[model samples]
Target chain A: MNWNQIRTVYGKEMRDALRDRRTLLSMLLVPALVIPGIMFAFTAVSLKVVKKAAEETPAVMIIGPGNSEPLQKALAGSPKLRLVPAASDYAQQISDKRIRAAVEIPPGFEADLAANSIATVKIYTYEGEMKSSFAAGEIDRILREFREAAVTRKLGERGLNASFVRPFEIKRQNVAPPEKVGGNLFGGFVPYLLIILSVVGAMYPAIDLTAGEKERGTMETILCSPVGRVELVLGKFLTVLTISLSTVVTSITSMALSAVGLVHLFAGKVGAGAKAVNAATGQQLPMVDPVGVLGVMVMVLPLAVVFSALLFSVSLFAKSHKEAQTYASPILFLTILPAMAAMLPGVELNAKLALIPVLNVSLIGKEMVSGSFRYDMMALIFGSSCLYGAAALAVAVRLFNRESVLFRT
Target chain B: MIEAEGLTKVFRDKKRVEVRAVDGVSFRVEPGQIYGLLGANGAGKTTTLRLLATLLKPTSGAATVAGFDVVRQAHEVRKQVGFLAASTALYGRLTARETITYFGRLNGLGDPEIAVRTRRLTEELDMGEFIDRRTDKFSTGMKQKVSIARTLIHDPAVMIFDEPTLGLDVLAARTIVRFIRDCRERGKTVIYSTHVMSEVEKLCDVIGIVHGGRIRAEGTLDALRARFGQRDMEEIFVAAVGGESALARQDVPPATTR
Candidate 1:
């Protein structure tokens, strides 16, 4: 192979691709601006919606207001729930979302408690509606407090303390560090985006360099040169790899900056409300580890090569740019499915899974981001990815060498 | 020098039908001589030139260019030959100088050599006005000039042009015809293929009348006219390929179009 010729081809292709607006959009603009823009928009909207749902005071109707005057007074006195007048069509009102929930205090409910008898209070709500659900939860909390006070009064009558009913306490805590917590939370997501971005980044240039040349009638001119087919393929492959890696880096940088900016904005604006929002959603703002992120980027290298080679090989079968896109669509979907499979809950990477192409990279990337390094698995994944990349490159070279494929009508 | 001993190329279509694109073609052209292979659209003229240029390997038979076997030493053959087809195009995004320099480098020329060749080709082809401009916006004539410069950048010993003036305007076509003549003046072995009888009469030192993937007649314009008992070159071509009826049977219009 002629290294000089390869460099010549690579340099020319890179310059050509840079001048192309389509390649620039996919490799730089989309990953750097569009992705982070969508992420920021989605996060801001969801947080705002959650916070609104938590803060809204919803109206509730008492079905038997006269039978439990004290209970009605207590419900009306609470700040979270607004007691509405007695109504027979409480279910209809809840369904219409006019009233958040309805509390049915049974007849003689206080007399049953006074006689130490069991009575059930049914709270009706609009299922699956966020505001209604919040209202129902507040009503339930107040009812539970009233019942506990009654129990305490009963204990006082028996000359006993409230501690007699409770034997021990249970507490829960997380042992993992914040970085691991963040990694575990965003691990599946980050790798999935990076893998997809890498593939997307390589797509246009691969199609443009191979099939685009054929359509433009430049393939014959280049074929007549002294450079070998293998060298030419290598040159083109390296160009695609460079664009693919650049896309991933741009996306990572954009996402990191967006994450930091959003974190700071949330801290400054909502302060404790952000924590309340996180607690309500069972998610915390993740603290990304710079070193761990670097590790993930390192692991993505071989996989990027694999995507570049595979895309090039597939696009070479097409005779035009449009046809090349058709040929490459299936490959994009195939990679996506495996990357998504790695994101499923309980889908941990095993020895066998480490040999799979996109899935292995995604799974291992998650671990790397979480500050965990299973070197054996990492080596296995890296080696297997390299093998796949080499094989795909061989296929590209072989296809490029075939006159029938190159000059197909 | 260039030589072909029964060079042939076969292809199979999508329906599994076999096609002899080039069949048992034999010819020779010495340095400084212009050999024109004249044929209609699908008479395997392009295939023959492609085989000689090492763009496509011959299915049967053998050929040599510049003392190297086309099949066994394709890389060497490519290094020694400059090929330009009418369909061949330039990289639209590259400047004319860059395009020429790129091919020079691909041919293993050093930086100093490429720079010198780029300047000379630019001057020779009258491309100085657009040498530093991207080729996408150039006129057909200007682009053709750049393509010629790129083809000759390596200073190869043999030049193969396959219908290089197919779709050019009169001025552009004249430039290409002049370039072919210039190549021969420089002692380059030139094989020019076309279906135009006037080009053959005016340019080729030796002419090969090709029909159905085989050369039916081979000689100078005068020799062919004498041997076929025809005064006009087109009549000589028509008679050499078989007769008027054979041309009719092949579904080809008379060679008067281009």
Candidate 2:
């Protein structure tokens, strides 16, 4: 009830938390370093590995080179595929990774093709191995080119054009802006990280401010002051919220910078690899909009409060920091499950889902960051989250006032 | 002034068994008087003090501190009372001054007033050297001084000391004993709890001998000696709680065994 007392507690707790190495690690350093660390490893390492795999020429063995001289010649002419001598151990070689893949040309394959008969060419590969997959892909490409050349020759002999085989063309284009494309790509990921970091950021301080006080014998001293239980809880909750928000902000900024740096760094050096990444994401590696980033941060505020209060309440039940951690693990997992639910395909923010606590924030956050704002749903989720936060805070205050809990032995 | 009438506290264990941590206990301590509640550990001494300090509500009966009901006006009672225990500790990350300033603000003191009181307590407790340093590195005596300073920051009228010297070395214990005496000299109503008979004999103006959650005997040290016909304070305490069986189990010196 007393604002000044709450401010005093908040300021003191913030100062104390800032000085604590554990809290600082969770709040600032870990998120800041971890996001960039992960991003750098994910982007740079993956790009290098994929580039190497694509560039490395994998040896291939043709089972029947005599049956298809033109096919064999075309495969040999390709710079990406190296044709090895026919051998009985070609399958063994593929399995042992000595050869990346093997091609089985059926008997009379050229005759069957010239007679317009269907024949299947089997491409043997080491499944799931990157290099073998790349080699198999190269063989498939060369086979398609060989078949296409034969088709064109057959069409010309019949006095037909290449277009005679095709009726119409299918073309596709992305209507959404690049920012939305990036948002759609990273939306689930960014909010997932922010929500998790926010919860984790609140964890240590919530435990320290409540159970740590009990462990250190400062609980009774603080409780003996004129500050009411509500005020005390509010002050501690605000401190936790402040730290949690700082972590969210730090991680968002770190991830944004890392994404931008990685995009620029690899865009030129690994142009083809970058294009592959862009193709995988279905965009040109769009930058996350600054406005959308700010919006996500704003949307995460109420959710942070919910986490802070819940963590504070759960940790207050424990009598020591270690016990508090034990008590808080379930809450962490519980928050994570709902936050991750938003990342699931087809899990969109709806009227029903918006009423849920963490899931709503995540769903709405994903949408908000992707340049979509359903204000009604946003207001609903925000309001519901605020309600949950208030309820959790009330529970924390109630627990703080309970003699059984505060003086638990 | 402080008063209590038939105060009691009951707790339920994990097995659903009711345990009377504090029974019907009554006492009075006027301003400028030191009332010591002498009992062995877990004898409801801490519970009784906690009840009067508004840290815990009583299951029955009532108490008042500095003209405020401990339960209904708990906030006001806390504002007027300073409570400390040997178990109560300092924020290790905070400097002594910050700790004092924090508690002062919690007690509803303004910045200027807190500043003034911090200076006075710092000088009076002789904490000038360590006041600006973090308490995690402080010795027991220094930490206890900081705790005391924090307790007295708002200058409450009533003081509660619950085994404040329990874990201290001789010098630190002496400092606490001196602080209690100073509280009495400043016209503050004080309730001190300890199992140490020497502390009662040396500091208490009135002593309440507590046992099994009840006050078994209440009077001055001289009055208790006269009533029990025992010269030594330990003998007087033994006689007050239980006559001969407790005396056999007690570990006091052989000279005071009789």
Candidate 3:
């Protein structure tokens, strides 16, 4: 096919799409707006909920008369947990609902502790609550610790040590790369967006160029031109791919930007031996290297094209603009199946997944997120998708030229 | 320059009955002449033109347009023919000049040649100023002029126009009639379809009246009038297409006439 003719058709359709303000806005502006908009809203709401939960939890009141000094110190050092000492107004405070929970200790608590007799601490709290239940559970936990310490001290007084009761403490330090750190957060839905976008992007131009042209009554005029049928179909198919690719790129960009934002939002809630930001300077601490993100972008491209072409082929089966839309709707769900399958947490990225479109992309994206670049699997995904895209594009063109498809009207 | 021999097309679906849109239709048109296919809506005038344009292939028989078979050499047929159906079928988003240039490119013309032809057509059609404006924003007459410019872009040897003057004002219709006349003057063959008898009388060198999948009459106006024993072409056309039943019955007392 002459590239000039293809360019002519492509230029005209692109101009047409641009002229349609609504369609143009739907394509570029929607993605630009929707991703950040949704992310911002969710972030604001999440922060609000967390802050509210912290605020609503009643302060922990320590009522131990003696031998519970260590327990009081632990509660005092926790910045997140508020510490309130038992007072004369404690009874009135409980009755007035001023406190969600309180721990009450008996007078001979220290004597019972030294004798090693069974000692119980009274804990008071409200019934049937949300965060208050966790608060109440925390109060009981401290009371249990105080009792254990008293028993340990009593054993010491009896000329024996509590070492036989327990072994040494256990500690684990995770040294995964920054990208992997982010992946551990979801390991679920983050990668699926790429697959969704490529399919959506591929579908828009196919339906618009084929069915849309028919609806506008321009297809007949186009067919009458001396332009070859193959050229016409290819021009339209390319437009759909371009649209789908742009969407995929935009979604990925949005995802990356959001990832950056989320990384900063969770600056303190992460591991060490890596530079953690103080949340003061917006400067990134280089948690995940730039190479990993680039790898993810490369990995997503092939899968994007494969699914995009699949959508293109399915859309070509439509006889009219309306029929094309109906033909395209079901394929949206089809993409979701692979997305769901790829979402099993702790699943490993492997070469066996290279044959699957959505699953392969998700795996590769996962690997990229974790700062692991598998060039071979990356090549397999991109090569297979490009091959699939070319095949799908050919089928779409053939369907377009078939007398049975375009001439049905 | 253009001919159809026993051309036929059958349309079918799973449940509905089959439709013979065109049946054994035959006709011929030499260069430097206007051949009018006159028929009512759905009378197969447009279908016959589409078949000749190679937009749709004939189910049987043969059509050779500009020395190219409409079936075996369909692309060649398209290369030589400029087809315009009743539908304006213009891309709403493209400017008139861009629309013409796009078709020129499709015809495989070089950029400079496309530019030259587009400029010449725009000036000849008296659409130079409006040509740069988006066609969707054009009036019916302006749009009709652009559509004409589109068909003329490839400079084909044969022009197939199906109801070219449809929904056109008097002035627009005049321009189209003049364009067809110009095509004939340039020795280009044209297969024109219209239901307007005056258009046929004034411009067509030959006329074919099609009805119910058949050509009811084909000849010069004089020949048709002589055959019907009527001087008026409209009266001949009325009598030719089984006549209008109401007018036919009203022309005589039913029982006595029977």
Candidate 4:
């Protein structure tokens, strides 16, 4: 293949692709704006919803209120859960969803507590109601605290230490640094989104260059030139590869920047909340490492080439733009399945899994972000993907040379 | 110079049934001459031209352009021949000058040579006014000019035109005819295909009447008129496709370049 001729084809296609409105929108504008915007908005919205849910005061009714004034006082003192008026039929109130939950304190509960006997307090809540569940949890916590207080008082009266009631204490710790922890947490989602966007960005230009050329009657003119079929296919392939790679790069960069900004914003609020417990905990959310970003970009390169070649070959079969779209849409689902495979729990990056295309990239991306490096698996992933890309490119060049495919009616 | 020896093409559909689109067709046109190929629709006129252009390979026989065999030296043959069709499609996003330069570079012309040729072809085709404008908004005639410029960008020794004026207006058709005459004046071999009888009569030095994928008559216009005892070219075409019954069944109206 002549390099000059290939460059000429590449240059012309780039000129055409750059001028296209839809391609510019999908490649530059969408990744630079839509992706980061959507991720940030989604994160912000979900965080706000969770905070609101935690802070909201949901009403609960106390049933059989004649015997437990101390229990009632304890319940009213809880900051998050509010005690409403005792309903005559509190079970009806819980079932009707008017109240989130109701607590039942039997008539002999104070005598039982004075005699140091076991007594049960029943909590009723509607199943599957979020606020109802929250209320139940709050009431359970208050009952536990009241029982603990009684135990401490009884122990002190008997001249025994409160420590005698405890057998052992359990403590948990995480050894991973912030970046690795962040990588492990958000790794699957980030790679999945990046692969999806890369494929999407490559689709329009692939169809435009191959099938679009045929529809426009320019394919004949180009084919009639002195350039070889391989050169033609490579020229178009590189053009598409550039677009797909740029898309992933821009999207990942913007998403990373926005995530950092969001982390800073949320850290302030969370740090204020953390001051009540431990002040340093809120600002420690992990980030994707710079090395991990570079590794992902490299690993995804072959996959992008695969998508570019596959779309080119498939679109070459189509006689028109609409038909090309029909031929190309199924590829999205085909790639989505493997890209999402990394999101599943217990799916590790073993040698066998590394041979898989999109799934391998995703799993390896997760590993890279988590600060795990298996050079053998990375090599296998990269080499196998290169083979796959070459194979697809061969098919594309073959299809391009076939007059039947090129001039199909 | 151009030559063909019983060039044929067979097409098979999904069912594997074969149809001979071009069957043992043969003709020749020397340098400085225009060979007009005449036929009714589906008489293999376009197929024959495509085979000669190396766009479609002949299932049997052989063709050569400027001494290069189409099958063995397709790239060389392509470098020496320029093919044009009636559609005259241009890249809508590319300006006329860019379109010409793109084809020139693809044809292996250097940058300076491509520039020089683009300028010359633009002037020759009368496309200087809209040379820098995108073709999406171009009229049919302006697009045809760009098409002609791109086709001749490499200064190929042979030209192949397949009903290039089929849907063109009179003014545009006249421009193409004049261009074909100029190509021959520059000592370029030309193979022109159309059902327009007057174009063949006025422009072609030699005429080949193709029917059912085979040449039924091969001679100059007067020679065909004398041999077939017919004065009108349409009647000559009717005879070549098997006389009046075939003429009665022609789907496309008889095209006259009057």
Candidate 5:
């Protein structure tokens, strides 16, 4: 009951936990490195695939050979493209994945060009194939270029300069706050993913430290000492909370750095966002700030602390590592339903949402990533998280005090 | 003095069928005496011990530890009663001194008082060598000594050791036996439970033999022996249970009780 007792228990436990390497790795090392690494890798791989596929022109068979030469020339220069002779049964080949697409150019050939007519070319592709849409888009782009070339040629034939063939070019740009920019690039994912990571990061340690002590038959000794249940719970809860929040903060830093390709390790998970026009040498766009990065981290840390305490409470009931995990897995399922609420885009984080603990925090986290900030909402998250943390810790202490739970075997 | 008057404890389960763990147990031990409650597993020795320790509330009847009601004055009882159970292990992460100091504080001793008590208990229990060492490094006998130190830390007037030598090797057991005797010499009231007849004969000044949720016999070892008209205490124990052989069967761990 005394502060000294709480301090003693807390000090000893923290020292022991800090010395334990597995606790450190689970709570800090893994989250600080692995999560960001996985996210960056995912982002990088996806970005590469998208960019590569966007530039490629998969083989297209011009069925009618109506306007084949210029389209073939445009596709030939692209390495991602190939030109194949039309099969007698191109239909079967398309279904069998032999060719990416078959283009049906109307049979008019040169007549359509001389008539200044609106020509139509049909591009055939199987639905939902990798790079298939790219091939179709390339065909469309080719058709547009061909129309411009034909008009210019016709004007030249009449001795005009054909200046009207392409009078202007279209340019697109983005103006968003760095965090929002970060979010836009990898925004929705950061909040929810970090929340999960923070909670998950604390899971093993909380269980190992609190419940593990009981299973090992050491808690009674510890508790029978001058330490009261409240002090013991507080000390352990704070350790778990510290470790969990540290992981979140580290993830936030890693995600931010990786968002700009400053760290290649997690480039795939949170790749570079839209490049800004430098206007100096017309090089690649500048790596701007990511979208809604702050909000995601702010919201996820509380959730992480709540889950850490909760998992610790349950884990303490388990008698062994295997037994702890058995209960922990079900608890993991408990988290999933609440966490899934965050993935719902456009769901409002109302006052009701903040009262529900995990799901509410998740909703707040998602809202944060969307660059939405409410001071009251923030206070609710912090308050409720701490309250849940205290409650879960009380449950853990109750389990500690119960001889039946500790000696379940 | 300590007293349990017709104290009974019935552990209720989800099923309505009731199985009494302890029933109609009554006894008294004066200060400066070691009272042994001898019973095999499920004989309610532990339940009686728990009720006396204020850890479990008795279902019926009443008991008091050091003039404080076990249930209503649990905090007061805890303040005066020092409990050492086989189930309680020392904090491996803490030094023996730290462990004893902790319990002393819990018993409401001020900082200086706890420090004085910690030093005296550790020294008296022969824990001086490893009192500063973390419990994780202590040998089995050493841990038991530290556990004894923790129990005595508060300088409680009443001390209860429940199967305290359990899982302990002979050397550790001997140290505990000596410690119990030492408590008696110091004029402390002791409630020590064990089915170990040798321990009872050698250590208990007054003994209570329990069976089937009640005390079957209570007296001096010689008196108990004479009651059954047996020369050997083991025979007296066997004869006390008559033909049931319940005492012999209960030595098997509770897990084997099919």
Candidate 6:
């Protein structure tokens, strides 16, 4: 295969792809804007909605509170939950969502506390209801604080300090750097999206270059040229690879920019300041080192090639652009399986997992974004992916060279 | 200089049922001569041209284009042959000049050489008016001109035209007929295919009547007429294809009239 011939084919295909409005839309504009736009809308809208829902004064009904005036006073004193009059049909009300929650105190609530016996406080809430759950949580906290106050008061009456009962304290601290913490939390899905975007980006171009040529009647002309099949296929492959890589870069960059934009937009008003910025958006912001991100992009190359080759092979089997699309649709789901596998928890980048195709890339990519560069595993993943990519490319080249497949009516 | 020695192509569908699309078809065309393969649709005319152009491998026998073996030296064969189909299939997204230049470069011409050839072909094909415009909006004639220019950009020694004027208008078909004659004048061996008997009589220096994947008759127009005792090329073609039984229904007068 002559490299010059390959370059010629590559240049022409690139020109064609650039000129095709459909290709441009699917490959560049959609990836670059869609993810970030979805992220922005979800972040900006959900932040306001969740905040508004949380701040609403949810009314709670306290039952059997007359037996314990202190408990009733404790529930009423809390600012987060408003104490509503006890109702005979509070259970029905909670189920209907008219009331957030209901608290039922046992008949001997005060006597049990005085005798130093354990007393159980039952809280009823609409399960799976966000607002009701939040209210239930507040009521639980108020009862715990009330118990602590009672214990302290009794201890002080006995002329003892509260520390006597509580000998030690447990405090949790996150030792990971902010970048690593963010990477670990948010980097899990980056590999999945990268794999999906790389496949999607290469999809249209690969089909256009192969099946599109046949449909346009240009395939016969190209086949009649002096360039060998290997050269032609490789040229088309390179174009697809370029498109896939650019898409990965553009969409990832767009996502990062949108994250920064969202952080800046709602920083102070919604407590989306530094502390809550990452947590507020359901998706963790990817804050890994630039070098790590670069390394991850590099790691994505072989997988991109794999996707390009597979798409090329499948599309070439189709006789027309429309048929090629039909042939290629199932591959999207096939790719998503491995990508989604990488997103699953406990699927770490071990030696065994490195041998799997898309899943391995996802695992290593996740690690790279999380500020954990396991060179040994990275090498394994890269080398294996290259082998798989080459194998897939060889299949594509063989398909291109096949007379039966190419000239099928 | 093109030769086919019993070249054959067999196709097998998914059920493994074999159909011989081109069965032992053989013909030869000398330099500066236009050899026309005259056959009806589905008679393997396109398959024969494709075989000569190295687009398909012969299941048996061999063919050569400009003395390069279609099977073993397929790349060399492609280098010396320019194949055009009936569709006038130019890349719609590319300008006429861009399409010519792209094919020229693929055939190993450098940029400067491609530019020279592109300009010469454009002027020769009289496509200057729409040379720079994207071909998607081009008329049928304009697109055919672009396809012709693209085919000749590399100046190959053997040219293959598989019914190049099938869907063209009268003017477009006239342009292609003139182009085929010009190729002959330029000393390029041309293999043209069409079912139109008048086209064969007008242009072909030699005619090969192909039917059912085999050549049934081969000779110049006059020679075929003299051999078959038929003055008309259509009758000569009918006789060459199947003799009396196939033509008795179409060419013969009614028995009552006789």
C-alpha-based local distance difference test score of model 2: 0.86
Candidate 1 chain A vs. true chain A: TM-score?
Answer: 0.93
Best by lDDT: 1
The C-alpha lDDT values of all candidates are 0.88, 0.86, 0.73, 0.85, 0.72, 0.84
Kindly list the per-residue Cα lDDT of model 1 for residues B105-182, writing each as its tens digit: 998889899898888888888888889999999999999999999889888899999999988999999999999999
| DockQ (CA atoms), all models | 0.57, 0.52, 0.38, 0.52, 0.37, 0.46
Task: Give every collision pair in model 3.
Answer: A201-A244, A202-A244
Candidate 4 residues lying further than 4 Å off, grouped into runs, are: A88-98, A106-108, A111-120, A124-134, A153-161, A261-267, A270-284, B247-258
Residue lDDT tens for model 2, A289-389: 66766777777788889889999998998999999999899988998898888888788778999898888888877877787788998889888988988
How well is each residue in A182-242 modelled by candidate 3, as lDDT tens digits? 6555443556766677677667676777777767778778887777777776676666667
Query: Number of the top candidate by TM-score?
Result: 1
Query: Residue-wise lDDT of candidate 4 within B56-112, one digit each (tens)?
Result: 888999998999999999989989988898744788999999999999888888889
| lDDT of model 1, residue B99 | 91
Taking the tens digit of each residue's C-alpha lDDT, what string does model 1 give over A1-409?
Answer: 7888899999999999999888889888987889778988988898889778777789999999887877888888899988889788889999998899999999999999999899999999888899998999989988998888888999999999898886576666667777788777878877888888889889989999989988898888899989899999999999999999998898888888887888787765556775775786565656556776787788889888988999998888888999999999998999899989988878999999999899998998888788888999999998998898889889999999888888776
Q: Please state the CAPRI-style docking class of candidate 1.
A: medium
Better of 1 and 2 by DockQ: 1
Best by DockQ: 1
RMSD score of candidate 1 (Å): 2.8
- Greater-lDDT candidate between 2 and 5: 2
How do the residues B1-258 of candidate 5 rate in per-residue lDDT, one tens digit apiece?
A: 799899987765445446576888899999999999887777778778777876666789999888989878766777787788787776676778776766676566778988887777766777778877888888899888888877887778999888888888988899989989989999999999997989999999898987877788889988987788877767777777654567656542231010
Q: Write the per-residue lDDT of candidate 6 for residues A1-409, one digit (tens) a residue.
A: 5889888889998898899998888867886788778988898788777777778989899999887988998889988988889889999999887889999998899999899898888999999888898899899999889889998999999999999999999765556775676566767677778888888899899899888888887788788888888999999999999988888888888888887887788778545433464564333443666677778788888988888999999999888889999988898998899888877877777788889888888878877886778999999989999998999999999998898788776
